[model samples]
Target: MRCPFCGNLETQVKDSRPSEDGAAIRRRRSCQECNGRFTTFERVQLRELMIVKRSGRRTPFDRTKLERSIAIATRKRPVDQEQVDRMVSGIVRELESMGETDIQSEVVGELVMKALRSLDVVAYVRYASVYRDFRETSDFAKFLGDEGLSDNEDT
Candidate 1:
């Protein structure tokens, strides 16, 4: 592996282990040139997945983009990084298991909303407002009501 710190071409793996979830392999490595240490993770790619946008445009699925969106929703909430990661992983696994090369953007959004609903209510609302395109208070009210969430639950 190439060393990220010094751009060295040579690196030695000092340790290797499966990640906590066993979905990936974590490797600790040191650059042979600078002796700098770094960690790397390897995940299996079941297949190339594409996202079908609302505009009917198809694009390759991006994991980082999904993570960023979820992170924004969970920001400043009690949700920890590990939980966010697990949610992302779960979504990805579900998508992969679907065995479809192309998936609707709405499907992905709904999956995120569902995951956030269970993780944190505030985060769910935050994500819902943007995903559902809430323009008025009534939109939020209707969404809460449809989801069977009472005002008391938000507190």
Candidate 2:
């Protein structure tokens, strides 16, 4: 692979290991020209999946969107970036395994919420607030009081 920093085509792999989740392999490389080091991920690319939005519009699945949402929800939490990455990968794998080209947006949202809920309640609530569009205090309260919600006061 070309070096990202120096645009050098020649690079040496310093290390290679499977990612924690085993979905991809992470390679540490050093540019022969500039000695710059960087990491790259090699993963299996699955078939494209389309998301059916609430407005009845279909769009290609966007991984960045899922990552961004998870990042926002996990902000300031004990969760680490690797955990977030694994969660996103798991969700994508689950969706693809269903063999559905078009998945409802609600399904995607629920997947995120479910993953976040297990990671951290505060994160779960933060994600749910935006995904579910909680406008009123009651809406927030109901979510907090939901049966599946953690009863921890800190959340």
Candidate 3:
């Protein structure tokens, strides 16, 4: 592995173990030139995936982007990094298991919504506000009403 600190091509793996979720192998390495240490993860790639956007544009699927979006949604919530990582890994596995190289953006969004709804309702609402593109308070009200986020009893 290349050294991220000094750009050295030579690095020695000091330790290797399965990740918390067992979805990846975590390796601790040290650069020969700089002697800097860092960690890297190795995961099994079932296939090269592509995402089809709403505008008909196609782009390579990025796990970082998916994780970042989920992280943003779950930030300051009770959800921890392990849970988020597991969720991301599970979603990726599901997508790969679908046996399709090309996946729709809408499908990805729905998957995130479902995962968040189960993980944390506040995070779910936060993600929905952006994903659903709420324009006003009424939009939130309507969404909360539809999704059962709002209280059922009258004041």
Q: Which regions of candidate 1 deviate over 4 angstroms?
A: none
Residue 131 local lDDT, model 3:
95
Q: Tell me which residue pairs clash in candidate 3.
A: none
What tens digits encode model 3's per-residue C-alpha lDDT throughout 17-52? 999999999999999998999999999999999999
The top-ranked prediction according to lDDT is: 3
**Model 2 vs. true fold: TM:** 0.85
Q: Which candidate, 1 or 2, would have the higher TM-score against the true structure?
A: 1
Ranking of candidates on lDDT, top first: 3, 1, 2
Worst 10 residues of 2 by lDDT: 146-155
Number of backbone-clashing residue pairs for each candidate, in the order shown: 0, 0, 0
C-alpha lDDT values of all predictions: 0.93, 0.90, 0.93
Error of 1 at 138 (Å): 2.8
- Worst 10-residue lDDT window for candidate 3 reads 146-155
User: For model 1, how does the per-residue alpha-carbon lDDT over 1-155 read when each residue is reduced to its tens digit?
Assistant: 88999999899999999987777899999999999999999988898999999999999999999999999999999999888878988999999999898999999999999999899999999999999999999999999899888777645
Winner on lDDT (1 vs 3)? 3
RMSD in Å for model 2:
2.3
TM-score of each: 0.92, 0.85, 0.96
Better of 1 and 2 by lDDT: 1
